[model samples]
Target: MLPNEFSSSPARVSGMDVGLRSHMQRIYNRMTVGVLITALVSFYIGHNEELLRVIFGTPLKWVVMLAPLAIVMFGFNPARMSSGALRLSFIALSVLYGVSFGAIFAVYTGESIAKAFFVATSMFAGISIFGYTTKKDLSAMGSFAVMGMIGVLVLSLINIFVASSLMSNVIAGVGILAFGGMTAWETQRMKEMYSSRDNEEMASRMSWAAALNLYISFIAMFQYVLHFMGQRN
Candidate 1:
């Protein structure tokens, strides 16, 4: 009887594990699609140097560059937003982000971009898988990762005007590490956020946020690794 009970416990746990895997799989699938769309759009623009300059030329460049940031800021605002509003905001942000990413194509060879992207994807997948599977608490790591991300952003803005090569390299290196950490933290967060009681409307918004976070982290990490690989268009 004890042997039967022990065997049944493993089976039950396995069943629960399978269900959780499916939920996480859906989250990843959505994130991956969003990333692919963003990449394609960005690369198309990047490859067309003349088109890029025409749209982002002179005084207009500031608007073009800041558009995505504005939309993302809108998405983050908790007040006066419906689920549909959030979804549209994310879509707009992703497109604008792709446009911003056009510069990557100008900097890296196509083959190198591809290779670096694959590397980043592999790393993101591995960490996220562990985060979803592990029972250990990751909340502490998440807080640290969030602080690191804030530091990276502040430094990146300062470096934009300074154009210091050393700062740029430091930003790239630390940016990769920060996002890598966030990937795991965000994945675990997503797992906790999901539940059968969640309404479709609320879940949709939650999923969009999860997808956006993962997509952004992957793109940032990929760009940094690409820089390290010294990819030249």
Candidate 2:
């Protein structure tokens, strides 16, 4: 009986690991899709002069720029929302972000944008891998990163009206660091949140939530990297 119990513990642990991997995979798949959607939409709008002008040249641009933030702050309640609703919201947010970001093409050279993206991708991948494989607890670091992000957001808002290039650079630099820390923290959090006992609906909700977290971190990092690395067109 002792031998049987001991042998079965390893099997159970292995099974749990497999489940965790699958859960993480699903989250990453959703995040990849969201990123692709945002990229395609941004590219399309960026390339279309007429569409770009209609969106960015008019008062409606405020809606395009602010809607995602509004929705994320007020409407994104994963606990209250179904998986389907969360999925739709995620897609909608991605589209809104793409619309908001379309102006980047006009502001920055293509080579600069590509370089920034590659750098951001490499940084994100490395940090995320470290977060997942490391044995250390990152809760403290994650908390600090979240606080830094809030401070960055406030500074960014203030800088909008201040219009100081130096301030903008500082904000961008801080944003890149904060978002990089967030990516690592979030990756670890997602890994810790997985459970083999979760039902389909619960699992789906968790996946979407995790995906959104990672997606936001990736996008924020990319934008900040671009601010520093991108050449003005």
Candidate 3:
């Protein structure tokens, strides 16, 4: 009786598998779209020095830099935000990141930037695949990666004042490692988040939130990878 009650019927199991795949696909699609928006905006801003100066030259740049962090604060409270609000917040955050990251063009050669981008994409794909396919539980690794990320953020702030190029490079290197683990862990967690009982609105809000998580991980890894691989202009 217990075995019969606990087992899912074959059709039910098949339906569940299909639903899981569909949900996972939605998360990936959303994440991809967000990444493209960021890349395009970054490229556009990076090419126009005048616009870059106008935005980054003054105190207003603080808002550009801080806005992404602010969106992340909102993202942490996804339970309170509606799906539309969460989606708009993600878009705003991505554009803000692009604007802030325009400095990459000022410092790195185009060829090096392209090379770094290609390599980062390949690496990201591999890590994400591992996370999706692996049976190993990554929950602890996720916690550790988050701690590493906090350390990197704090060190990055300190290095800004210290003006140490070596330290900056070190930070970038560590950032790649930290965000690499984060990408895999985030993928696993996103997969684990699927619930058959969720309503459409709930699923969508969660999807937006998960997409933001993956988008952040991907962008951070790309930036750090580019920093280390890119040639100075």
| Rank order (by TM-score, best first) | 2, 3, 1
**Candidate 2 residue 180 C-alpha distance from true site, Å:** 0.9
* Order of the predicted models by lDDT, top scorer first: 2, 3, 1
Clashing pairs in 2: none
Deviating ranges (above 4 Å) for candidate 2: none
Between prediction 1 and prediction 2, the one with superior TM-score is: 2
Instruction: Give the residue spans of candidate 3 off by over 4 A.
Output: 1-8
Write model 3 residue lDDT over 72-99, tens digit each, in one string.
Answer: 9855457888888888888888888988
User: What TM-score do all the candidates reach, one by one?
Assistant: 0.85, 0.97, 0.92
Kindly list the per-residue Cα lDDT of model 1 for residues 4-39, writing each as its tens digit. Answer: 999899898888678666666766787877787788
Tens digits of per-residue lDDT for model 2, 1-233: 99999989999999989988999899989999998888888988888999999998999999998998897887677789999999999999999998888889988998999999999989999999999998999998899889889989999899989999999888888888888888899999888877543688988898998899899999999999998899998
Which candidate leads the pack in TM-score? 2
Task: Report how far off residue 46 is in candidate 3 (Å).
Answer: 1.5
lDDT of 2: 0.90
- How many residue pairs of model 1 clash at the backbone? 1
